[model samples]
Structures are given as C-alpha cells and as structure tokens.
Target: MSGQPNRKFDLALTGRRGGNVWTIDGEPYPDANPLSVQPGDHVRVHMVNHSPVVHPMHLHGHFFQVGDAVQDTVLVPQHMGEVTFDFIADNPGDWLFHCHNLYHLDAGMARVITYVQ
Candidate 1:
C-alpha cells in the first residue's frame, strides 16, 4: 500500500440513455467540480457505478493503489458496484480522470484532480 489517503472523495458514475451522456457525481465532464488537493497529500476516490454498463476509470499523471497493486486505471462495473483506490498527490498540476471508453469519455464522463498552489 502507498501512503494512506488523507483526503477522500466519493463519486457517483451515472449515464443518460436517450442522449448517451455520461456523468460523474451527477455532473458531466467540464461541469463536474475538480477534486482539489495539495502536494504530498494522499487521496482516495470511492467510485460507485450507477449505470448499466462498465466503465474503466483512468487517471492521468498518477498511479493509484487498489488493494495489493498499483494501477493507473481500474474497471468499474455496473449496477451500483463500487471500487476504492488511493494515490499520493505528489505531482502538482491539473490531471484528468475519465472513463477509458472513448464513447463514454466523449459523452462527458470526466473530471480533473487539481493540485492547489
């Protein structure tokens, strides 16, 4: 396990059928509030999938520890299933977090993790 997460966020992964729009925490991509942290902070994200399809959640610029392994992405299954992972925010910048599915990414299943100054 990496550094223990001091900051935590719970996100709800959702989607709209008719329009094929994807969302995180009820907000779509650009509209979703960025997860903010400071350098050296350990962060954990609890992701809950509410949609009917699977979403491979990817994080840029950081690899997170889930259980015994470290990875940059993890698959989140449908039907309200959840996954939790933690990462150290040692990099200072705006990093993207999104669904690996190209269609879902295009549909707005994304947000940013920002390192505060």
Candidate 2:
C-alpha cells in the first residue's frame, strides 16, 4: 500500500434490491455483516451493482482511493457495473458503508466496517 508495508485485505460485495428492500450481499441494514480489519491495514472493496438503480457508494469517516481520485463516495452504475476502492484503516472504529441514495439507504442497503484490534 503506497510502498508502506503493513497489512492488507480484499473484499467483494454486491448490491441488490427487491420489493423496496435494498441489500448488500443479500442482507439488509443492521443485518448485513461487517468487514473486519485492524487499524492501519489497507483494505480494498470491490462492489458489483446488480440492482436497477445506480448506487453512489459511500464510506463513513475515511476517504478512499478510487481510480485516480481519492473520495469518500464513488458511483457504481447499475446492472452489473462494478467499482473498486482502497483505503487505509487509519481511523479505528465501527463505520457504515452503504449506498448514498436516500431511498436506497432508507430501504436498507448498508453494512458495517468493524475495526478490530
């Protein structure tokens, strides 16, 4: 990660919606599982959108590198479009990762990023 040797991880996720219920990897809201990593570890998440609506993916509390830009949010086009972002877990805490669309978030497309010691 940027030539700094520490720790790293990779994750894959999928976005889907059904009957007003939006989900990440088939689980909705608080029910969706967290991706566990430690402080200072580099984490990469690749998201695939299978839903009909576009998802502006967001990560709380930390900025991530997506393509050539560093951003807190990235847009994943619908219908199999995919996006990959990487970040160093400098802020150690539980955080939310989800779609930024109000309706989509309210409909339950969210997951937690749990930082473990």
| Top of the candidates by lDDT | 1
lDDT of 1 at 5: 72
- Cα deviation in Å at residue 66, candidate 2? 0.8
Q: Model 1 scores what on Cα lDDT?
A: 0.90
Please, what is the whole-model Cα lDDT of each candidate in the order they appear?
0.90, 0.78
Candidate 1, poorest ten consecutive residues by summed lDDT = 16-25
Question: C-alpha displacement of 23 in model 2, angstroms?
Answer: 0.5
Query: Candidate 1: misplaced stretches above 4 Å?
Result: 2-4
Candidate 2 local lDDT, residue 7: 46
Best by TM-score: 1
**Which pairs clash inside model 2?**
none
Query: After best superposition, candidate 1 residue 30: deviation in angstroms?
Result: 1.2
